[model samples]
Target: MPIAFSANLGFLFTEYALPDAVRAASRAGFKAVELHWPYATPAADLRAALNETGLPVLGLNTVRGDLDKGEFGLAALPGRETAARAAIDEAIAYARAIGAQNVHVMAGRAEGETAERTFADNLAYACTAADAHGIGILIEPLNARDVPGYFLTDIAHAARIIDRVGAPNLRIMADCYHMQIVGGDLLTRLTHHLPKIGHIQFAAVPDRTEPDHGEIDFSWLLKALADAGYDRPFGAEYKPCGRTEDGLGWLKAF
Candidate 1:
């Protein structure tokens, strides 16, 4: 069976507005689409695009607090509950507006027991809020190189957090690009953590480019996912080297 692919609009289509990007993904044969921080776009316009194109939003990320100050996220920071919860609330509300299925609650840079507690508490709140709207929460383990000092950097760590929160709707967003950089042995890690994985995303290893030219053998990687029974669409999250459409040979190559 052909793989079901979802374009990560945040990285894939830089040339168009979010709504137009959704339309482009649909025209390019993507089964679904995901997003980064799309708060700037009017939810109505994005929703209208979704309705017109008939594409489901797989997931979206909460805002990265104070980007100018290098704040990647706010969830795991101590003494920032108000800001953190507000971000979560905003993301859930936005996700609802655009009919997104999941919200990736980003855990910014931090450490120690206090940070862990903060993250868990915030996640619990997010999970409860999202559950009411039939949405799930996803936590991803980002690599240290790109997001140094990030609280969530290990899959097992993320799983432990999920277990701690014990929210039925909370799960992990397994990004192969970050995982490959932080931890090799993709198949084993993915299979080991398959039960708790809510979504799987991919790009080339070494460079966050289209998967077709990466050091990672995406053909084998995707096959491994299919063999493991991951029926959900695999998210194509990567930076296009040129115009987004020109870099889409990977879509056809798959």
Candidate 2:
């Protein structure tokens, strides 16, 4: 089977507004799209755009408060259970409204046993809420260099969290850009953790640009994913150096 791709609207189609980005993605040949935060545009409007373009939303992220103030995520912060649960609930509602398949629950900056316990508990709650809607809850390990002090930095740690939560709907959102920066063994780690992964995203490592410029060889990696029976959309979650459409030469064949 051919590997599918989803445009990450949060990074791509910046020249256009969120609602128009969905149409832009379809024009650019993507069958699906994902968003970092689509709350600014009402779900009804986004649904209209999706219906117009026939592009399904693959996944979206839970609210990460105050990007300018450097709040990356909230789920793992101790003493913030109320805020975390609220964020999860909001994500679930938005995802359900838009018919998204997965929601990535961000873990925020946190540490120690207390933080871990809080994160696990919050994930369990998120899973329970999302399961009813048939939406998968994903946890991703951000590379420390990019998002210093992110709670979940190791994929193995993330896997353990999923196991501890015991939520059948909980899975990992493995981004190759972050994983390559954290460690170089992309294929090995991906293969070993395949069973726990719900979604996969990619970009050029070091620069976070189009996949073609990277040393990771996404052409081979994507084929590997298909050969390994990964029947899910590969998310193009990167900043385009120029116009997003100009940088899509790498994906022309797909």
lDDT tens digits, residues 1-254, model 2? Answer: 66789999999998998889999999988879999988888999999999899898888999996678688899999988898899999999999999999899999998999999999999999999999999999999999998999999989999999999999999999999999999879888998999999888999988999899767989998788778878888999999999999989988754
The stretch of ten residues in a row with the least summed lDDT in candidate 2 is: 63-72
Tell me how candidate 1 scores on lDDT: 0.93
TM-score, model 1 to reference = 0.98
Best by lDDT: 1
For each candidate, what TM-score against the reference? 0.98, 0.97
lDDT of 2: 0.91
- RMSD (CA, Å), each prediction: 0.8, 1.1
Q: Write the per-residue lDDT of candidate 1 for residues 107-188, one digit (tens) a residue.
A: 9989999999999999999999999999999999999999999999999999999999999999999999999999889999
* Candidate 2: residue 75 lDDT (0-100): 93
lDDT of 1 at 6: 98
Q: Residue 176 deviation, candidate 1, in Å?
A: 0.3
Q: Pick the candidate with the highest TM-score.
A: 1
Give Cα distance to truth, residue 87, candidate 1, Å.
0.4
